[model samples]
Target: MAPRRYCRARLGGQSRWFLDRGDHLLDLQSAVDGDDVPALLRHLADTDVTWAPPGGAVQVDPARVEWQVPVPRPGKVICLGLNYAAHAAEGGNAPPEYPALFLRAATSLIAHDAPLIRPRASDRLDFEAELAVVIGRRARHLDAAQALSAVAGYACFNDGTLRDYQRRTSQWTVGKNFDGTGAFGPWLVPAADLPPGATGLSIESRLNGQVMQRDNTGHMMVSVTQALVLLSEVFTLEPGDVIAMGTPAGVGYARTPPVFMKAGDRIEVEIEGLGVLANTVEDET
Candidate 1:
């Protein structure tokens, strides 16, 4: 099988696009829009569409349209726990004995620019800026060196979470998977173009233009490759699946005087090369 080309764009008055397989030799166009890009993909996984070459210079309206989560329907949203050393320490925890891991159900994902709702059950909602790796191929027990090769691309994901709920449970699942908590991407750039080192990529989060969380991916306790390798060993990693590499410290939950998200708050997550994802907070009714 050749590398698959996945794209999300506005089509037919909705945010949607076609996935082309190598120069349009094969393709699948779908109308699934809003925040269900991934569902459209799974619907046409087995079909192939005829690709048409660009007839002329293609034009687009960036402002009038929007891009969504590359995999609007990922089967599993795998996440790294305590991958960031600083983040772990902030929680009064030591580095992971091994790669701490977890998964966020797909329903928690919201497309770019979607409103991040603050759950009525929790008052300490927070944002975790992370680099998300989109898996490209099925793999199990992959080696560290082969991990990057399995990646299709990378995107900026804001792991919106509720701190109080998360701490109440031994497992981080409930608090981390609140509706509209996962906001990522305006676009998913291919991994081939991403930075090669574990460092140099700057990740930051800002609330109302005030800087909140800032760090380099290099500080991760487990590098991206390491996390992939470890995860693949546990299960068959499928294409379009995502791995949120974990957020650095500075979460509202751990601040000296805890800060939480409220209605009217505008949070922005930015990764150096990748574009920023901005979303507003809306209180749950």
Candidate 2:
């Protein structure tokens, strides 16, 4: 069977499962084995990508449902820092000999069309456009050859950060974990649908319709395969886990005057082929 885009959503207080099949959404809940993304990924891996869609599944109206992060509860939301050479230099640092990594609480994640909150503590909310990988199976000590097989799919991520909070200490967890800052999803494109490691794709971050950061996935200092191989070496990767590959240069804090996202501005992170993840900025109330 051919690969398809998928998502989890809610409509009128009811959570729903949907598979994008071009013209309309096929309600996966109506399928013989109705389940969410994690379950679907598990089934695919065990069965070799053979999925039979619901024969009489209802067609869902996209306008009626609210998008949710494709991976509902990733045990590990691992993020990379300074993965791009230009991004590293912009921050006045040299590319590291090893990947700089951080963790984000699942509480920080927000769905597409949701508001990216600027916490009451600071207005330095910034955008970092990234490509996130969703792990499909349990993996430990993955080798270079096993990296691609462990991946479930790819999605767009806006690592909305509070610069001041991030720098207040050496660690970035506090600044990065403010509720509703991580904007993820709209859809997930299967790993089989793209080139190895999801490379060669154009990734961009735009603020209020103006492009702020743009680059190719190929520019990443630590390739996706490498990150997975390296990450698994230290920790076991589980199904539904997310690995945010890091952003390119042009982050607000590195600018001459440093522009930041404020209330009422629309921020969009787009990864070619995967789809766009867009959200409005709002102040913490």
Top-scoring candidate (TM-score): 2
Model 1 off-target regions past 4 Å?
1-7, 18-52
What residue pairs clash in candidate 1, if any at all? 27-49, 38-72, 38-73
Candidate 2's TM-score reads: 0.94
| lDDT per residue (tens digit) for residues 99-204 in model 1 | 7777898888987788899988887888899988877777789897777777767778999988878888788888889888889775565565556533568999
lDDT for each residue of candidate 2 in 171-277, tens digit (9 for 90 to 100): 88888999999999988878887778999999999998999999999999999999998999999899999999999999999998999999999999998888789
Candidate 1 weakest lDDT stretch, 10 residues: 21-30
Candidate with maximal lDDT? 2
Model 2 score (lDDT)? 0.87
Candidate 2's C-alpha runs over 4 A off are 1-3, 32-35, 43-51
Q: Cα deviation of 234 in candidate 1 (Å)?
A: 0.6
